[model samples]
Target: MNGLDLGVVGNGTIAGLVNSVGNYQWLCLPRFDGEPVFNKLLGGGGQFDIWMDGLVSRSQSYDTNTAILRTRLEAEDGAVMEIIDFAPRFETRGRVFRPASIVRRFHVVSGTPRIRITLTPETDWGDRKLPAVRGVNHIRFNDGELAFRVTTDAPVSYVLSGTSFLLEQDVSFILGADESLTDTVDVITLDWEERTRQYWTKWARSLAVPYEWQEAAIRAAITLKLCVFEETGGIVAALTTSIPEHEGSERNWDYRFCWIRDAYFTVTALNRLSAMGTLEHYMRWVRNIVAQSKGGHIQPVYGIGLESDLTEEYATHLPGFRHTGPVRRGNQAAEHIQHDVYGQVVLGVSQSFFDSRLISRPGIAEFRQLEPVGERAFAVHDTPDAGIWEFRTIAEVHTSSAIMCWAACDRLSKIAAHLGLPDRATYWSERAAIIHKTILEKAWNPKVGAFTASFGGDTLDASVLLMAEIGFVPASDERYVATVDAIDSTLREGNHVYRYKTEDDFGRPKTAFTACTFWHIDALYRVGRVEESREMFESVLSSRNHVGLLSEDFDPSTGDLWGNFPQTYCMVGIINSAALLSKPWSEVI
Candidate 1:
């Protein structure tokens, strides 16, 4: 219930979602898929210099359909200013926020008030060497032996550039209110700020949002889009990776690459906002995946922006967030075969066509490949696979995996009918029915009256909540009701929703899954628990950082966001849940 304890309790754990006051706590320079250049939110400042502070009242919000955050700063000395930060989005995507870069501009609105500025950089998350006195107002970091200039508008008063600067640690340069050090830095000219303001204001007008809450959604969408590299149209799951699950827990991972499962949600969310440019870019990425083998089968994830190599690496130089070990960069799970991803991909593309007035010609052309793709998924519909949970343990016959296959087939059938294709609609329909029956019989335990986490496992799973979401079971079905009850009683601990607590064959206990929690709200709404659904949704939203962004998990006690920051699936849950909640019963769930 209390606001997130980002500063003290979860110190250095990337508090970008929680902080305000014109301070940037986390950022990975140049590109989202690149190693972090500035990551103060993960604890003890990252690789870039930051210098913006004032005794000012600050509030943040998006400007309409754009992902730009406008921060209004009211100084204690009566000086007022506004700062706009946005990453520009390309129109090749639709119905989503797509600002390209995080541009910050400051302007005086009232009396002149001095602001404190600081610039800091974590060179390679502690792997790069820092050369002192490199620049009068800057420092050069050796990230991959590449020089990064850390420049700012602040004075260099003894900075805490880390004791391990020789070991590639983070560095900072503080800027004071006094004008004495102004000449030492490259102060952003007023013309540049004016130009940025005009550009953003004009771009905001181009977005098509229907309500006041649209601003926040816009920001969320844009931030998600920014995580996608434009060159490859690959959407990375998050900005930073390998922030451990809990104190000393070794569940750290590298999420700075693309996930096939996320493509569907990303496309659907963007299409809804009419962000055609973003949608097209990702669709291109998907097409490339399909082209790999001329089939729809997909790996669980891939390297971002055409980076074929996704080998995982341990960052031995930088201490992990709060000293959690095993900081990593690339995702070794790139070749993973999660069966449920096929459904997610189909659903993402299908929803774009079904729900929105916004359509892209190129996007549509790419989506038409589903017929061949669906056949490939059908080829292995019943085979055991890495399930949606991505367990490090042994693979299993997860009920959700089968249900997702059914979904893929079911949607493929409809899309075929819509497009007037001579597809095997009857075959898909029959196969889908069989898949549903198999799940109900093999996955269900009558005594528990709920779906098990996997075939032969006694433990119930939060994935049971998705039985209604994918239409595998009617929301009003008696078994569906019991499944929700089972999940709420067992899996729901306070506000956290663990995937399953029992250690698998690999001896690793899965952490709480945030997307599953959001899926619970959808299940609740589908079964006509509208009021209860609203309450749950609000409670989940409260778990978000101050900026309304969620990570992979939230600590029930301290409200610290555990796992990666600005997670893609969590954001997908936000968009989908919002859609379901906003619809009338007769229209949608």
Candidate 2:
């Protein structure tokens, strides 16, 4: 059965998800948001499968500190085989060589193992199957203008016919573009694998990870890096799309594009680990979005290539994940009036103005470009629109949006002071103060004994905990502590936290929003409940899939992962909580 326990292999340009038995369940070719060449994860008919006849046992894991995955399979007759999977990524000739390819190596460990290889690819969301054209040593699969070839050392006739053959020696399969290989399959595969391993280890050595939970932090960091589209620097929210938040909920939506709010949290978490490369690339993407906006409105989400019109549509042909219907392609939130985007735009780029380690630091001219964003934030701090949750029908002056708007002005004030512009600092400072005062007066609900989701509303929301997170309110503040207590009492279930109990267009949420639970844990630690916070953190960490990966939502009752796979928001939670809750290196070292 398909599950989220799958391991991810990527080279920043392309990615693939492999199950425990070494099946390519999901893979997007050409790019991250490109066509799904292998769509079996979403209940489609296309997948790359390697079946061990009479298999009895199997296990899968990643190479230490790297995205390379190895799966071991053993048959009843004592035949053993190991499969190594990865996307080729390494520095060569003064530039990073991250190709749009996946490399698979089949190694015989013990006896002669009979293996059957099935390579099927579908296009148009699994509605059309590509016709195969065979060659001397390779097979080409083409549909319309799209085409890719599998160059392998195995017999071409056996591969095309899905015939089971005796694997007496090691073999290699390079699934990539239609171009032919320059070298032999074994030579290039071995060389690329070694270089990729070295590149990942070197990158991992640079992370300033916390003392405790080092493994979890490293895995999450690498997964987050995989989400980045190296060509454009836009980080996707997750790899797969239309995986429902819960079973049969019809809450499925596409997460393959870059969301402004999600990108801010992603960059902030990576920044904590001193992974400044991702932040720099993402800042360039943000700057492009701002320039395209021309100091006007900004969408909450956009294509990684910066295409604006993300009109939502359903792929009627492909059944959703786990046979749940309604697999969606594009996101409808692009047209939403998500006013908080203004604040995210400013916050996402704020560090560039202050961090001297960056090669190109932002100056007065960059600040001038960002001022209009802050002005828009100040303009809509109290206006009604979709909150962070993106409610379709209900619109209110959401406290979370207001607080982010405040954050925009507050950070701009600090950036102005950093650039030695006292007058502009005062200007942004005064605007921040006004927004802060208004939130305190209107967002707090004395009737509920906490700050609610929206201004003048009595309902509790998990997002209000950001008051302490974004520095809207100090952790030591009485109201902030009280709000944390109120949310803890209301939204928490076991170790998981729900966004809210209120009903929306899709009815009530049935599972915990994985990232919100992390926020609750951080709030607990900030409020001097260290022991309880650590306990809750461990409990939530236990819910991660076998490979230490998380999705967007989790069911505390069943401990099953839901929503999109390898969610960037949930991975950011792992990085952030590990950083905050881990003991200092001085104590351990």
Candidate 3:
């Protein structure tokens, strides 16, 4: 349960759908930015949501491999209405972004089920549920309260439930159209479930990555699309309101905002499929933010809509779901200076420079590959800020952060030369040397043969796996193997990888991070453990949700999900690991 109320269904834990009653009961809408119209999830206290409209059952499915959700709601009256919610994919736009928006289509099937949709809107973070009042075709909660209104052209009157009631559960329900114009005389035109299903089928055919784990990859690709912010080119990490680091613990935080690092990982996730459109659009936002002399010193996070003014406020008016307290909206972490994020962004785009798919974007396609990489690396070479941990504690120079810096410049320089970009060989070569010097000179303790989190921290870090994977050291390098062996011996709790012990460990996280798990796989592959690498890859994939979706963390003890939901980082990890495994299978089978 969460701070938002109502019984849970999808929770975006997997694909979501409501029972019957045509209640978009599970959606947080307007634009994933809007209030919870029917958030009977997060526990059910925020908005008044229930399936009390009628007596019947409901079921749902995805539109092929796409993020389109279609729910079939049946009525005791023998009437059926299919409710479809999808934010249409864009092939025409100059940029590739499918934000947290929804397009809902409702149509009737058989008997007339008394259709009821409650419009109890809440403001802020589900704090105030505005009372509903209807005037003309516009159903507004403007009785001294207004978040949004339900407007339609047809005649839907107040029914026994005190919510909008339709006499028939017909396909005639136009999502945002007036009921009077849409019903009987038919003022608006709309397609049924058939058209919606076809739309997804066509898009699934658009993906070109058809290797060993393509199905799982496609699901993640579609999930990443939903995580994107539509208006701006930003991509938020996940869409849900609350997921505790440990359930019911005070560790719950909202992740509806964008992290530069997370978005970068998303671009890399789609790299194999030539999803360059997504990266170009994302970089537009990146350029705008970094260039702006904003108050926050180029903070690591932003609002999905580029509304950088995200404030953290708890809704005091609404009761929390299952009584979980401090339900919040907007991320407070946005204000923090995360130095490591820069490396992640640089690394992701650098990976793109090597991506041949990027060869299609006009000037961007004709874009020079390597020189820009060096220039960007030069831009932040010595500027100290928050490291990758995004630690709430004081900032320090972390080894992993330094490694990414070296790796990013190294990879991007190669990509730039390969893609016909400015090479800046002297600058890149010298910078690479300096970065390498900085990392080894300041980050290592020779006695341990493992990297530390910061310049001198003694704790063994889960992040040390990056040493070999990022090419900071050769896979066979003694120090690199020692670091991996150290992690295998100490950092792992069964398969769970703790990012150092934290207060969030109500006990340690149950399952190893899916991303870190893949990190292990890649390390195993790099060090010549092909069978071990494949086994590790399979173990991580086995933890996916029923539909193959993954999250930021998992509980190894009970094998439940933790951290954020539908984590882009973990998905990208899967893509990287799967692609790596494909090479071996191609050699053999």
Candidate 4:
């Protein structure tokens, strides 16, 4: 029941996760950060399921070039039904018609099918169920601040009583904000579906995909795009939180908030596919966040709407996934001083200034605003902070954070030069050089023959694998090669890679981080282990679920994806690995 078998549909305002058998398992209403409307994925919660009572078989797939999910269910009586689920989103007049709605259409495909529909929506994290009021043509559920209505052509009494009925013609259901349905469900759904298909297909065609592994890359691209909170131009780490990096490990934390580092990787991958829309929006979002920060004192994570001070707490009422208790909300990491974000912000925005394709090319004003971030990077390159892994109780000058600081100054030098500011370029270039030398001097351990995870420390970590990717060290350099070898020996369990083996808040991680495996694969490719890298990439790809989706973590021994569903970081790894290992487009013809 991992996310690989689930399909996600979003209208840039709200999203829904539908299983292969047509169950709306996980969804946060109104916005990505809102309370859950269907949280069955987290355990003992409510769900909206239009399923066959005695289902014999089921098949699921997405509509061509769209996020629309289609599930075909076969009952033991040989009756078949096709359920199409989508969040209504399309251009309406001058604005996008992305109402807070989850539209479901049921069409009988074969003999009379008995379908039971359940629309039990629980609020307050499944502590209680909302009271429903039946109307002439709709059913409204009142849950204090989160009232919603279900408009359908199906019998209201049948829906309320959960009565299984024979399907004759097509029926439509729209669960959304409490509003009147001015048009017929069939006509409205048909129009939205066609327009939504066109919208996605056009977006897909616009991508500059590599000839090989295009399908995998596209699926990943779509998933990553779905993670974006369009109103704020912020992208979440994953759609759901508290799925557990390792099952019942008490490591569950809400990932619904935006992490600057994760969002940077996301945009970087999307940039590779020439998806400038997200890149542009994210660039603006990062700028706003930087502007809001006091003297470039930035946190690694923030709310989607740029709200700081996210207090982490637990929802003890709701049982976690697989009955794991204490589902968490509001990330405590928001208060952690993860210095790597300064570099990530600069890296994410620097390209827009130089890239010609961007609609709004950043200029001198933007560069001036960014200089403060670089200054912060220079100041914090040697400071202790929560490392990229976000250790709850640990703080250190992580090599990864230091290297990112070096990258920030390095990119600033290029951007400065591009703007014809030679003085600024020289200053940034010198700062980058000094930081680079400092990292090599303090972070490298000659005894271990690799760059340690922290400055002057002996612990090996998987993050050192990014040395080559970030241009801190060339892939062919002896130090870099040794670092990769050391990490491979220490962190690699079979083909999967763990972020680190050190004890943290929840003790050492028990499962593999999927993105780390991709990072290992990319590092292998860079070190000219082409065959090994290719084999490893395929192995990781094979671990993805049925719909070519990946979660935040995976049990390497069992090949079960854990953590949050359709994690943007993991999805970005798929896109990046495919592009990095794919054959050139010249060979496609």
Q: Which numbered prediction scores highest in TM-score against the true structure?
A: 2
After superposition, candidate 1 runs with Cα above 4 Å error: 1-23, 43-66, 70-102, 106-122, 130-216, 273-276, 351-369, 505-512, 583-589
TM-score of each: 0.79, 0.99, 0.79, 0.98
In the range 1-589, model 3's lDDT, one tens digit per residue, is 1221111122121222243333444455545554665555454533322232465777665656766566677767676677665543443346433323234455666665565554454554455565656655555544332244454444546421356455463322222322223332233224323443454566566766647887877777777765665456777676665655556655556777778777877877776666566776676676566556231245678876677777777755544434565567777777776555545655656654454555433234423332343455545545555666565555666677667667656765555455555644444656777888887777677777777767776656677677875677889987777777767776666655666553332443444566777777787788787897787677778877655667677777777776556677787887778877765445546
Q: Which 10-residue window of candidate 3 scores lowest in summed lDDT?
A: 4-13
Ranking by lDDT: 2, 4, 1, 3
Give one digit per residue, the lDDT tens place, for model 1 in 143-204.
Answer: 35434444443333433342211101112222212123333332333333344445545555
- Candidate 4 lDDT over residue span 1-589, tens digit each: 5444788888777888888888988989878888897988888458788868678999888876678889999988888899988887677689767778888889888888878888888888889877889998799998778998998899888998888887888899888889887798788778877888888888889999988888889888888888888887999998887888876799888998899999999999999999998988898799899789855589899989998978988887788887876799899998888889989999887779889988899999999889999999999999999999998889999999999999999999999999999999999999999999999999999999999999999998888888898888899999989888998999999989999998888888899999999999999999999899889988898888777788889897877888888899899999898899888988867
Per-residue lDDT of candidate 2, residues 383-484 (tens digit): 999999888888999999999999999999999999999999999999999999999999988888899999999998998898898889899998889999
Error of 4 at 351 (Å): 1.1
lDDT of each prediction vs. the true structure?
0.61, 0.91, 0.59, 0.87
Clashes of 1: 48
- TM-score for predicted model 4 compared with the true structure: 0.98
User: Which sections of candidate 3 miss by over 4 Å?
Assistant: 1-30, 44-59, 72-83, 88-119, 135-155, 158-196, 293-297, 318-322, 351-385, 415-423, 502-512, 583-589
For candidate 3, report its TM-score: 0.79
Give the runs in model 2 whose Cα sits over 4 Å from its true position.
none
Clashing residue pairs found in predicted model 2: none
How would the candidate models be sorted by TM-score, starting from the highest?
2, 4, 3, 1
